[model samples]
Target: MNLLFVASECAPFVKTGGLADVIGAVSKSLATTGVNVRVLIPAYPAVAALVATGKTVMTFDDLFGGRARIVAAQAEGLDMLLLDAPHLYDRAGNIYLGPDGKDWHDNDLRFAALSFAAAQIGLNGLGGWVPDVINAHDWQAGLVPAYLRQDGRPAPPVVMTIHNISFQGVFDGTRLSALGLNADQFTQQGVEYYGKISFLKAGIALSQKITTVSPSYAAELLTPDFGMGLDGLLRERQLDLHGILNGIDLDVWDPETDASIVATYSATKLAGKTKNRAELEARFGLTKSDGPLFCVISRLTSQKGLDMLLDCLPDLLAEGGRLALLGTGEPYLERAFIDASNRYSGTVGTIIGYDEGLSHLMQAGSDAILIPSRFEPCGLTQLYGLRYGTLPVVARTGGLADTVIDANEAALLADCATGIQFAPINGLMFGHAISRTCALFAKPKIWTAMMRRAMRHPVGWDLSAAAYLDVYKSALAP
Candidate 1:
């Protein structure tokens, strides 16, 4: 089986969020399954440095409507074809922004170039390789499936995965003609969303099959609030859509092997975890306490429910626990956390920007992780926290609901349960859940049991990649 992956982000080369993590892990896993998997992405400036150090293969000429030079480069033992259109991709900072700290106004054409380039590569032959199945991720690659379907080309089957529905690429319908798409495509059956050309909608309407990151998220998207105005379209293709829970690369996140943490520990030798907690407290200048240490490592965006965290802080502080946070987003929320840090200097510490090393430290040191997201499509931090014996306290939504089960519930909970779940996203509800967790912590035996169980929770990509393989096979079948 030959698979071609089209995505905006991939780890080590380029990354902005969970999307990169998913693409990189899945592609590598599929390769292990004996499928000839290849990836296509824009050759951003940061990744160009790798091309200088690695062997570059002559791919093919992308003759969509004009000339586009394509180059294939190998990295981390994986084959990746980088679309070299300096006019469109070569810019200063990371993707979605320039040096001016503003979104590039031409992102529509830039990613449109990516989709068309990838579509042509599959058809015209890139590096003498052709894909049996073309998998597209997010709105950036959304237009490819639509282009393949509407252009009447007997191309490879397409499977479009919706990592998050909130970021549908909607632009003016006038830009359609520039890409040689018909003007009549502005209707409901096409890229139209209200009066805009929604790139995600086009893919959802045209792709052979669709999938989200988690099964619960698949059900959530069918509702009015979580759908982001595309629920009806997903409903129309319900039979072809699936929800596959994402997996984490245990090699990178495993506590015993991780060098970032102060001490190494696993499910068997749990005593080493206390040294990590002590180191974390010393690093953050928190006073030593036997109380459980809680941490929240996420963006301070409204979507992450940072506002709710603020509202719940006073109550949480009154619970007599220490807290540390590591992430940056939304200036107001950042400032609010800073102010809270000042108010509770000894008990709370806030580090604004994200540090991957610090994330590992927190996971290894903290007794619990908080994720009160407004609506999380699929959260990776919770999975990382679980693997590190950090009990996750999350709201009942998206993958958080799907992955974490209550620690105090059923008979099998001793072996499988990992975290706590709150019913609502409000402050009081979150505070109540925290209190219940504190009550559980008072019982050291149960807490230790829960931590061991959480550490044993399996979320590897083997099962998820197998499920995706099944989806690809079905999509390719006549």
Candidate 2:
């Protein structure tokens, strides 16, 4: 199987969030299954530095009216093709955002060039390397399917995976001609979304198959709450849609072998976890206690339900629980957490930025990881928690709902529970869940069993990669 993955970002190269992690891990996992997977991403500064030895494979004269070329290189054991268009991708603080913390004005043109190049490769092949399936990820590469369709040629099957529907890449319809898209495409049945061109909508409209990060997210996107104004169109393609739960890279996330954490431990031998806990307490300058230590490693944004967690902080401290957070986002949220750490000194510790090493330590040391997301497409932190035997207390939404089995009476009795899940994500419910987790923490026998069960749960990409292969095969079917 020849598969081409087109995306804006990829991990260990250039990453903003889970989308990059998914593309990086899934592409590698698929290659292990003997599928020839090749990835295409923009040559951002970080990516260009890594692929400095990469050679130019093909050059195009009229790609978005600029001299664009494809540079083939190998990174993280995967074949990568970098779209080397310096004019479009060179200046970057963030991939999509400028130095002023706003989106670059020419983002539409930048990504349109990326999608256009990907379409050319999908349709005509690069150096006789035609892909059997062209997989476009997120709004960044969403126009690939549309560009291929507009080529009016028999092209490889296209599949678009919506990592997050919240960002639809809606642009002014006036820029359609500049993007090389037909004026007629700016219609209700086409890419037009309320008189705007929605890049994600174009993918949904033109791709042979559509998939989201999780099964629950797939169902959620069919409703107005999660669809971001594309529910009706998504409903029309119900049968063609799929919900494949993403898998974590076990080798990188495993607790037993993680060098980032203070101590290495497994589900069987958990003594190292205690040492890790003490180290975490010392590092964060928190008072060491036997109380349950809860960790939060996520973006401090409203969508992540950080506000609800903030609201429930007093309740959590009242229960004699300790909270530790490590992430960076939303200025107000960062200040709120920092203030909380100061006000509730020793009980709450906040690191207002991301540290990869600290994240691993937080998981290994904490009793439970909290993910009170308002809506999660597919959460990687909870999956990492499951692997580390750090029980996740997540809201009942998206992949959190699918991956976690709530430790209710039925689940505990059946011995199949992995973590605690609460619905109607709010301060009261999240606090109640934290209280429940603390109660469970007091029962060492039951809590140990749950931890073992969580560690035993499947977190690797084997099954998800196989499911993706099936999707690719289905896309190629006559």
Candidate 3:
């Protein structure tokens, strides 16, 4: 099967979240399975340097508005087609952020150009190779299905995966024409979301099939709270909706193979894990304690339960613990963490920035990892942490609930167990769970057993790709 992925970002080339990771890993995995997978993403200024020269494909015009060109490239051995829209993409900073320090007010216009470009690519064919299925990720690529359906283009069937339904692209309904959307599309049954145009809704309403990142998330979208106001539409299309759990790139996360970590260890031998913990302590100028070291590497956003984590910090630190955080978002949350670091000095260290190497090291070094999201669509960090032998303490929501199992339960049934799962997302509960993890880590035998269990568990992309292949076949079937 020939598949073309349209997403806002792709890993290594560009990334802000798990969407990029899925796009890059899944494309490569599908290719390995004998599928010709091509990717189309914006060539943002921050990532343009990563694409090697002489890979520029021919230029083309946007199907909706503006002129655009595609630069051909390969990332981690996967063929890629970059949509080069300098006027829309070549900004001074992150793809979503401008140098002026705010999201460009014309985000709809920019991504609309991307969506139109993707439709044109499928319609015109790539070097006489039209995609069997054009799969889109998140709301940015949601427009692909909308354009294909509304523009009356003879395009291949489209499948849009909702990584997180909460971020439905709700713009002013009046801007439908400017977005190249027909006014008719602004009806109660179309892109309109409570008087606004929702990009994700358009995709779900028009695509051949709708898929979320995880099965648990797939079920959650039927509810009012997690649905982000599209539960009814999703319930209407429940038969067409699916929840496909994401897989991590094991090659990039294996401690033995990874070079970013201070030390390496395997399931059979965990001496290096101890060395890594000490190294992490020293790097962060933290004190050596027998209590488990819990690390949180995520953007300080409310969606990620930053407030809840902050509320639990004092109690966690008071109970003989340490934290090493690496991420940037939500200034108040950042400062709150910084304030905690100031008060607890050696017990807590916060780095308000993103460093891939540091993240890998955190996974390698921490005895336990923390992820307490209010509603996670699918979390890649916990998967990475589990693979690295850092038992994850994640909330029972979305993929986190599906992936991580309680430590005691995991040991009772080693064959089907992985990490820790907490329910009733609250600060007190989060602290209690941290306390439990610390108690388990205090015992070497139990902690070692848990690490071995986590390492043995598998969450690779092959299984996920196979499931997606089934969906792709269904989309293209006569």
Q: lDDT by residue for model 3 over 177-223, one digit each (tens)? A: 88988877787767787888888888888889888899999999999
TM-score of each: 0.95, 0.98, 0.96
User: Could you tell me the lDDT of residue 159 within candidate 1?
Assistant: 92
Ranked candidates (TM-score, high to low): 2, 3, 1
Instruction: Give the number of the best model, judged by lDDT.
Output: 2
The clash count for each model shown is 0, 0, 0
lDDT of 1 by residue, 15-82 (tens): 88888888888888889999898888888887887655644444434433344566777887578878
- Model 3 ranges off by over 4 Å: 50-52, 55-58, 61-66, 409-417
Residue pair clashes in candidate 3:
none
lDDT of 2 by residue, 124-175 (tens): 8888889999999988898997788788899999999999999999899899
lDDT against the true structure, per candidate, is: 0.85, 0.90, 0.84
Give the 10-residue window scoring lowest on summed lDDT in candidate 3. 408-417
Instruction: Give candidate 1's whole-model lDDT.
Output: 0.85
